[model samples]
Target: MKQTTFLLVFGVVLSFCQAQSETGGEETGGEEEHVELFTTPATKMGAATSDFGYNLFRALASRESATNIFLAPITVSAVLTQLSMGGSEQAERQLYRALRYHTLQDPQLHTTLKDLLASVKAPGKGLSTAARIYLARRLRLKQDFFSLVEQQYGVRPKALLGGNRDMKEINDWVSQETGGKVQRFLAKALPRNSAVNTVSAAYFKGKWVTRFSQSGVMENFQVDGGSPVRISMMQQDNYPVKMGADSDLSCTIAQIQMQDDISMFIFLPDDVTSNMTLLEESLTAEFVQDLSMTLLPAQVSLTLPTLKLSYSTDLLPLLNDLGLAEWLETPDLEKISGQAATLSSVNHKVVMETAPEGNQYPSATSTTSHLSYRVDRPFLYLIRDEASGALLFIGRVVNPKDLSI
Candidate 1:
């Protein structure tokens, strides 16, 4: 994936609005914002990215896999943490664990994210993520919680009279924040009178750094059990790629540069006959970073399937299955308002599309192929923000035809 041309996106559109009585507070980006965010060192970026990446996919390990699974862990982390700003005791601990951090005392976690949020906010950065909260009329909001969200996450709660009325606003905001890459934030307006609803959406459109040739050819892709599936394969010869083999994971690991500060890593298992179970177990932020540090550039011929995929799922059940039902309980969020308001629903939608940049490869490298790396089997990919080493999206492509939502 180069510059934003080839997208491997992870987006979560989770809404956490429930029913509540009467109230007062400005409808900011998030109902949870009221104060300024604390600024901390950027050095913690690596640790923060590592923590979130590891905890996120491990949680997905228990998820249903008959279909594609795509997500942005940071979206989930931001939502849970905003809740934690008003959470206490065990409830907060649950969020802490979900975020793959020590306890709530970890300033680096939020601050590191704060910095990343700011970095992406710079002029014209294609990778973007945003969270918005819509609150039911009269619902109370905490000052500290609101301020923390506003300052750290750069979102303000947009207080609304009803969920239905707020749907359009949420959709528009989401679309604008994601550079118009995602617009359908809410299929229909939410039920009227929910206490709180938070929506987080991420969208990406990037170009390839090294353009693949115009002549696209159909190739056989090996699905699990060696079943053959044909897909349009994009090819490039003698391209500079960071390639390596992870014997322990039994997969070919390599980094595909997108542009400056962004890249996609593909983990293609040697044994295409096997399921992704082993590869799933091997994914961790540390392992990915290790590959980044150890892998060296080489002139390689790479063939990867042209990717075009989109998916959506209800995440509450998955969160519950991960043993965090207690964390979503109304009682657990007493600090938010000391009222009976629980998370309503969590929704995630992701879109990924890739193609050659149409820029002709240098004539010199067009013919030479020292090492061949063909992604002709089930494989996992990570779209990362290279500067902070934050994983933007993660998913596996089994059947290219099965990319529908």
Candidate 2:
């Protein structure tokens, strides 16, 4: 069984909150001092990657309209950008165009990317990211390229010995990187013609700032208005959330606070059978940031499902659709080595588990208002790092019961 050329792993686990709890659901961010974020090379690069991620999501969602879709845009873009550093001029240009980095004004792209990675994966941020380059035992990288990659990306290239040993080695690295949450990353043997391969993995375990009043209860979730599935829906009363309505998209957008300066934004359509095409089309980095700053505070009765889902698929076709056919067909990776190399395969997998778990015990004085926000239908969501304004994960849930897609 031949395996893929590249593997992108995205695993997220929602654990307990151990931060200092707010005594009541007080209105936050209303009369606060709004400080403008200082611009940096990494932030510029992050904005570009966020745009690319939204485009990729649109392509995937258009293809699988009824299935759940989840991916780490930052991870995929980072891996591709790292690979581009090893490409020839033409190949690099092609890859940059695909990533929408042609117009980016970042001079120190790699250095800033290093900084962004460090910031997101910093201790207690609930995000861990790792990238590696695997070369066939018969091949070798240029000394300069090897040093650059090692110094910038913080990983040294390794040999891909064929068969079960190769499988174990790669999977073991993945398991170690994600603290054993992601195991057996490579399910089968490497392809007979495998050459230069890249693997990127990220593990995120977010802790909510406020704890729910109690455990989840059985509730009905409408799956595209076809049939209702009974899902364990978590509930929170008098939640201090940033929420607003978007008339253009016919959806209500809400932001739920999480620890470590992270926020989870949810977009729920007006009707069960409503089409989310408009909302998906309108997702951009700038637009999302505007929502974050502009949406008003509210105290609502919030109810959402306890999500445990995983999705895996090949992103090659999608990349081709995104205008990378020429590069994928005949990649010019002369910087890596003199020998000819081709990158025609890329695989992606994402696993996420989040529930209502925290140390902030619910108090009697948390209530503030009587607004309601119930997510009983299909919805879209994204996890963002507020400190860096980087999109960590984007996904849509059409049917929570159907775990895999």
Tens digit of per-residue lDDT, candidate 1, span 33-102: 2111111234244445555755556566556564456776666566666666667787777776666555
Q: Provide the lDDT at 286 for model 2.
A: 66
* Stretches of model 1 off by over 4 angstroms after superposition: 1-43, 103-109, 121-125, 142-148, 188-195, 225-227, 321-323, 358-367
The residue pairs that clash in candidate 2, if any, are: none
Q: Which segments of candidate 2 are over 4 A away from where they belong?
A: 1-38, 359-368
lDDT of 2 by residue, 31-114 (tens): 131123425566666677788888899989898887788887787787788789889899988988888788676777778777
Candidate whose TM-score is highest:
2
TM-score of 1: 0.79
lDDT of each: 0.63, 0.73
